[model samples]
Target: MSTAPPRRAPLFRRVAAALAVLTLPVAGLVAVAGPAEAAASATATYTKVSDWGTGFEGKWTVKNTGTTTLNSWAVEWDYPAGTAVTSAWDATVTSSGTHWTGKNVGWNGTLAPGATISFGFNGTGSGAPSGCKVNGGSCDGGTTPTDNPPSAPGTPTASGVTDTSLTLNWAAATDDKGIKNYDVFRGGAKIATVTGTSYADSGLTKGTTYSYTVVARDTIDQTGPASGALSVTTTGGTNPTDNPPSAPGTPTGSGITETAITVSWAAATDDKGVKNYDLYRGGAKIATVTGTSYTDTGLTKATPYQYHVVARDTADQTGAASAQATLTTAGVTDPPPGGAVKLGYFTNWGVYGRNYHVKNLVTSGSAAKITHINYAFGNVQGGACTIGDAYADYDKAYTADQSVDGVADTWDQPLRGNFNQLRKLKKQYPNIKILWSFGGWTWSGGFGQAAANPTAFANSCYNLVEDPRWADVFDGIDLDWEYPNACGLSCDTSGAASFKNLMQAVRAKFGANNLVTAAISADGSNGGKLDLADYAGAAPYTDFYNVMTYDFFGAWDAKGPTAPHSPLTSYSGIPIAGFNSEAAITKLKGKGIPGSKLNLGIGFYGRGWTGVTQATPGGTATGPAAGTYEQGIEDYKVLKNTCPSTGTIAGTAYAKCGSNWWSYDTPATIASKMTWTKQQGLRGAFFWEFSGDTTNGELANAIHTGLQ
Candidate 1:
């Protein structure tokens, strides 16, 4: 999945540890010089926010307690052996082995007397740093910064009343220092401290009177005055004779993808207000929602699914099930005159240690869901396309269990390995097309040479792909040239028009019905990889462009402020702007590529980090996380059970457990992405490779279901 060179330690250290001080005079103010000792004096406070086994997050605050204004400052600390700072914010951080130094950024360098600045970092290994010093002075037993308490919060109001919950909102309080958080109290007992003016109190008893109040607090832990209390009685109560809501009206299903379906029904009546509706599929309860509609996801393609709904009351009473609604989802249907396309990639090397043979596709049920699979990766050399591995592609023999047709390969057979197995798979699932992909990140070095003789290169590819020995195994050719005139594993100076020229040559030789396609860079940054080629001109010669929308960030940035590899939307504080699915789709369409000719990319695996101290994203890490195949990367099958998603950000799933943090898409997130794809008018979706999925193809199922 990563096209970049194998990761190593970063060459440049952005942070360094030193106990030096540099002072500069303030521009529009008269000098008030102080003694050297007094000017160098400062206070530092360290706080541990979270600790998860091998990693922890810590915050450091420095206050200028000297009489004269301090022009600049630096903080140094000795990290425990085996520990390292992976990321830092609000300061320039650098590390030398176990020692870390943080210097004030330009904006926070100058501090007047009594002024404080705070910065945080993520680190690896257990325990806290020791021997901390601020501006060459001991940080231990330093003076604590002081601040005044905030003003009293305003009276609270309750709304959206329910038997078990109510919403509370109050006016914000003021503070000389910033209001850090607000504490909410129920019946004289503190419940929570929130940063906003509102809180939702849930799990209450019906018909019970409850009183609520709020108090404000400043960053220095100063609690302010409490707001006037307000009391409210819940609207409903448990009653033996209370009637449950009637069964929901006959449910109707629509918007069917290969793996998901949206069902909606009319609301039912209830003596007590209806609390929620329960949805069932295949005689099993799937979900309960407060809305009239629900999308049942993670389904198998081409399968018949029956669904119904029932209503419930505040008393936890349920009604009868409504009439069943049945629907057969779209499967590996042939591409219609003009419709969505679902494509996936199959790697030849997976047959080895991963034990993912071609038969696994059929056994895992992925073959029936996918309309096309690209066989990766044939090599590029001598300015021509060629088979990457003769044994893996067509020479190695397959056992009966490993073969798609349950037949053993003969020693003297003309074709044996993955190619023959693919031929059999196509026979079984006739609608599933196959393409031979050449020149991935590792093998893209030859594209520059290939561009020099497009016609000759296309001729070579045609001969190999259309070879009489295994001609029917492939339906077309997919160019995975990494980049045209930009840098990947290697740089190319083939010029901006090179890619369009190459695609035009291939299309002219291969013809239109043969399905010419390419996987192109989705870097949405201005003047990025998309600007390095003439993709718009090449679009006319290709069936579609597979937009690699994932891998925007990862542990590849070893000293990382970790982020999701594939984020759907741009969230606040995203490391890079426009490096998201929305931005890619918009930019591609803006570049004159039709939405229907673009396919979104989803990663079947996840990118992660180790020695992660924070439970949420934006935390720093010591280095790449440990994985079975490669550090910093793991298959979804392992993470879904070992880590499990705890929360979501930017439309992707992330988890934190012990010292590791991982981000990948869950079934629910995939469904949402599929909806977005349709809304954007994109053709469909595809994942990197098939072998990373579960034995039953859980992530693959999610992709199929969400696309519908």
Candidate 2:
């Protein structure tokens, strides 16, 4: 099914490494709100809690726990006595008296929720101060001796019982440091300190009522308050009680006929161990097996049974029931939703600013019908946190008569670097429509500011995107708001309506023929991250929502098996946050986003974790792995050579070589995935960048053939 495009000579090659020249869409500056640009710093979150000359530099964790994300934010912490402003990186620090404030310096400030930002300064202090907190939470002032916190009362359950004795059980109590034993008090008098959860009160008069309470002590000998009293009286051995026997072990139901269920388990032991196991249908005991196992015959098909084991002594005394396990005798239903959705890449031809060359895809037979092609960025000005060189960054790049070089070399050449070349390429390729994208991972931080003055921001973006200089270059505008109504860098707190307003303004500016789209958050583990973005609220105004589903697993999780880069079913042993791209898509659909309006994501390059020793897939990768551009990770181009063997499961590719491993998409894997995409009734797919694919189009080939 895959098709490779014919090879052609290289065109529009730039000296600099491939950097997408995203453009801001506007003209003459107009009055708006606050300073367009915030001071830039690589690390954006800044908070000051201490003053200088206090002798202690303030150290804290800047947590993005709120729903709103922060692209860039500043924190001002006052220093303690004798603590002077010393050095800083990725931040600009200013000190006045005991007050010290550090602002985000350049294009850095990015703090996402559940993500912590930490920065510290050294100070001349004799020892740790008694008072130190982070974001108002208690902090470890310094590495010092500490005592454990008191444990909470555990859940008490009944256990062994006979005519003469009654036993009590409870859950284990945990302590910060360590738990000493638990004190079991009989009638308020200290009886014993047991290391475990069981206590037997024996040889007491059958009619005597015994009250028991437990308290957990720490390694520091600090005792917690006693648990609530639980009183029990042993019954005389004359009455016949309805004590059920223990449930059999390993109870398994298989080869189930419509009218019967064969339930099997290990033999029940007594010693009170298990006398027998009872099988219940809807909380009512249906059968009890005195032997090892039992078959509940004449059972209706599709019935559900709950089973439990209760051990009984020879005296007919019964122990507490074991945990309940469920069994369903039913017919299998139709197959679940098809595999991961497939996305397609739509880019301007091999031209200036739209540098994503289709040649790599075409030659590799990857001419897949992409649902959408998003043109790089649209500029915004007169909005909150607009970069200072806004207009000049693009104006300077435009040359004589509309024959333009797409970008300028540096910020110094203000009024340079626009997407004019992309306009020509779009004109030549009429079949593929390009949507002008405004804001992305880097520029998304300004959205809060844009929300404050939606009209001005919209006008500016509209002017640039619709400018006649590059008429017909774009079909519509795509809003790549990394996150809205929630945290990305700092937070907006501008309210959820801010996103809807921004989209409305954009829709008004671009008109109907133009596509209005947005890139939504892909963090679906808890559903909190994606829910905060409010994609459903903005869906009515958008043409499609691009789910950025990659970047789920990266070097961040080094020293582990590559999580299913794209998983189908949830599996244990995988971290809670672990989810495949399909999960996110399903969530969107469940949240009311139409499948046709959803565009899936594909990573052109693979994300890797290195320093591995195992050759097989799903094995641990030792760290710290080094990334192609940074640390602890590598890209697909580099990874193919370093670790070539791939693991094929659930239709995706992953590799583990020694202590290093990587999760990536090969030509074969992509093809298999595309089949599921068609079956799922999804719109299409999109990739992060175009340059990361194979030169001969192998990966693209799979996409093309599979989607076809």
Candidate 3:
């Protein structure tokens, strides 16, 4: 808590003493220790080795090595020449220039030979130290860098239309004595000398592969090994004929009273082989046919129905869905009230789902106004035979029941372990519902395929969403195709009604009471590409439309004046994108999307910019800000402390210190938004997620209270 920097000793002197007596011999060790020739009886282990930037200040974990329980001990080490000791912890350490001394001073507990301990200190470094050891094992050397060498560069292992450029990742190196900067090289030629480890190898020739490597140098001109060579191939230029089949189809037309309806599709031909088809209905995916022809059975006696299928390959990359086809089943009457609502969080890929939880969301009052929870993704592994784009790149290790699971996966499990938690939450809060949202920013690539055969896509989704293994876990489905008939992550050629066809099939299969919804694009910059998608056409079949109004101005636009993430109205000089929520609403309303069926998006967290000297929203930003996910955005919890200035924008209490600025919605801002949602006659207001609120429910409480 103290503002003053802790004091310490000279660099060179401290290093000498510390390294000199780092190791000690116990009385028992001299007695029957195994292998007299060995350097010591046993070596101590350090597991949690982390570098907080650099210097002796970093923390280290230590393990006991000797047979006797350690009642006391000492640890010492010399830092690189330019480094100096600033502070010490977990024990007392005396410093002398480059050398440092530490010894146990407090309580003495039995440190069983194999037991571990942790300690840390704060120090400054200059030159790179030759050797760093813990219990005598050489760890990464202490660095006091002077000059930095360029990092290796290269491309990706594979490329495609969706992923055209290869991204190069490199290891970061620091110099001792004093670091100047870093340089990055591509194919032996300097490309860029960045301060970080990641670089996007853009403007690459599609399908052309490239290899790269990197090395780091310090101020003293000491060079490290050139990183191992890595290779990447750019996604070949757009080749419809050569590309694999599209995403599976979704079903439509569930409420009509008809005995039967025609089912047809645009024959799916792939550059590779088309193995067979998998049909889905009633939330179950069944392998219905081996060839293209499939006659759906078990129709109700005069009830509307829907169906979808997935084309598979030897590698199992399921092609896009055929246009969703709707049929009438016999014997059904009396439709339920309005359709159900699919509520939940939409998160990034690679991150875990347990990261989304009730604890992360609010449901107590206005915030709890949500009737459903939707999880954004499940993987569809890519290759020659790729499922939907989003599904392919998803984390497969996130099994349906591994709550808090944080691993990768090849295929999506029916129910993310988080779904079970959601299932339980529904039981506790029966008024709420749950849905599976597929195809987001990354997953949208598959929607084109889904548009081809809406019925088949719907069926595939039904099977996964309603997998009996987790029966009754979800209430319905939510289609988050970035854009329907229009362009989003990529282009969809199936025409405008492609979305209508898919939703219709899903509606038929889900019956009258199930939930069906879609997140319409908010790109109102031009002729309303979202409106052109004919959301109104799908409204008749969907329960509600989620208007994604956030992410208008992002790090993607390198230009300045970092603005609010979700602005209510467009201010002067605002970039020409649909950066405000109001623009999306007005556009949707103009397109005839009923106000009662439109849900406005509210960001739980705030987007921000750094290097801005100004204090207002439209103020010129000098550079980008640091974020938990994106560099310029900050989560609410983090913003609460680092950028309290965020609370006072527009009478909001947010603030910013240094270059960190945030745009979080406080209880008051939430109240204003709720009032606006009512004035606009919007169906409701939705937050990006349930997380980012205070523990006592301040933000959520405001929303609930304001909504009333």
Candidate 4:
């Protein structure tokens, strides 16, 4: 293995080059698929144009790829039992039961070399087309997968038990096409359809025991085998809501000491004067006081505690509980468990030319595989956080066919666009946590201003992410400060503590429940980006870090020797020292950051150039290779078929053809890297964006499988 030429500049302008617009939401889900793939001669590819609640629009592109003319092309596929083509346009579409066929129009049949034509049809039912054939050949220019249901979900775990409510969580199942949602059953009776890994079952009888199991359904609504049962017994007591005075306000703490603190809160308003306020440390009642304050003693020093209050009226009814307040005694708290965090970024702007959407997560089966989504990006400017794109965030209208819930957005709705759809997505996949990511390659220029007033920046972000209109859409916030005390799209000279201080401020505002994370740099050279900031010091304030381990090399250099942008290790003739993912992890770990707190980053696209003279790395080239979405950068979906892997180097795949070369991670390479990720005891793996994978999310699925 060998490296390529030196960097023109040690900067990765990925988003800036990939997207020129200044638009994205505070948070949203996004994904993409190639318009068409290759075939033996004339090829056809399918894409779901728009999905209304009741039906959707489907399109197919037929292209002549055999260096000859194609006179008339026919595409055929099978829809599930209830799904059918309702109408056709620019083509004659006909169906025999569930088997459908479409032929090019009389005037549009002929396609010369590199030429193409498209036809679309209105469809009912939610099933995607399968077994696609272009002019009697496989549509993928390879093997068409056999249709099969997903495997059974893992056995569930019961937690958060209460008299009337309890939560059930389980691992997700796997499928080739992708899992859509999970169906939970109680005592063999179907109870719920949820898109996430957990379910909170409520409205139950006290002292009752129930058996729960989960079954997964694929994108086509095919139910798989059910998980083993998990029996949960509700606590034996009156429902918390049945008893009450009004709920108390958030409790405040003062006179904090190593061993104790004075906790006070606003009193609950009750028609019957409040009899008492019951204070709790964690979930247990610690004290019953008639007044609004209590001095809790006997706490360990340098430990963290959570407190809440409930009110009881003269009739002894238990009022609702106040919001939980978290406090650390004497010192900062340690980071939590190092569980795996499989995260991905969802760009709000991808819905435009990419035509990706939140519903695509369900349709493409990605939502089932990912544990979290970092919606990129909100903006950081004027020393505070701000909306990246208002229209995309909460103002745009969506038709029922294009909406996540299959319900049309009303003009008078308080919120629409991605925010509304995200809220609906959470309702279906409650287990998939979302973070409002602020700043990226382009927007990060404002971090210098934000670093000057970290507290103000933190507060602004809190207010926006928690805004009532779409508050339910996000679980927390993610800082994508490209660099601190270093150069990125811009430069920052804030002291080393600036990064830690900003993270501390955000943690203070977001509290313990909500995730507070950041996309940190992975530069590992001496005195590089990692050395310029106090990431290790900030670990205490972060749930985990999404280490940006990609972009070590790319067409950013314009001309010269090609190399894998995201190399796993160093090799001969390397352009720079300590510029690989392994070096970054080693450096961070040496600095005392736990491996569990780090997630390895994977790129969903490739960066390359043309005019290459050799088939291997280190070959000189003229400039960047042509790309569909952006020059020098191409989505993996497109490259997988067009440039197919010609070789492997430094734990990644690369291709070379007729002076053209590109580097990207295939499902095979991704699986291998995931293996390395686990061996390193790292948290998990993540990718740049979702829309770069196949419609069925093969790359995302590979990550899911590798982690398992």
Better of 2 and 3 by TM-score: 2
After TM-score superposition, what is the CA distance of residue 680 in candidate 3 from its true location, in Å?
1.7
List model 4 lDDT by residue over 1-708, tens digit each: 001000112244321110001110111111112354323365565655443345555567666666545566777788889877755555677678889988765446666667766665556675656777766664443323244557889999999998899999999999888888998889865678899999999999776789998888776555555788898889985454444588898988898987787999998987757999999764457799999999988764544466789999886777789997866556433332555677888877666557788888888888989899998878887988888767677777998888878999988989988888888988888889999999886577788888889889889999999999878888999998888877665557677899999999999999998999999898877558887788978998998898888888876455656898889888887777888898788777655566677899998898888889889898887666766644467799999989999999889999997788999999999999998888766778888889889999999999999888
Error of 1 at 290 (Å): 57
How high is each candidate's TM-score?
0.55, 0.49, 0.48, 0.54
Kindly list the per-residue Cα lDDT of model 3 for residues 84-201, writing each as its tens digit.
5444444455657666655543432225566654444445443333233433344433331222222322222322323446656654654433333344556654566655566666
- Candidate 1 RMSD to the correct structure: 20.9
- Model 4 residue 328 distance off true place after TM-score fit, in angstroms: 31
lDDT of 2 by residue, 187-294 (tens): 855577787888877777774467887777666554554667888777774235544345346466766775566766655544434445565533345676676456
What's the lDDT for candidate 2? 0.52
- Candidate 4, residue 278: CA error in Å? 55
lDDT at 1 for candidate 4? 6
TM-score of 4: 0.54
lDDT of 2 at 140: 28
Candidate 1 ranges beyond 4 A from true positions: 1-338
RMSD of each: 20.9, 17.0, 18.5, 26.6
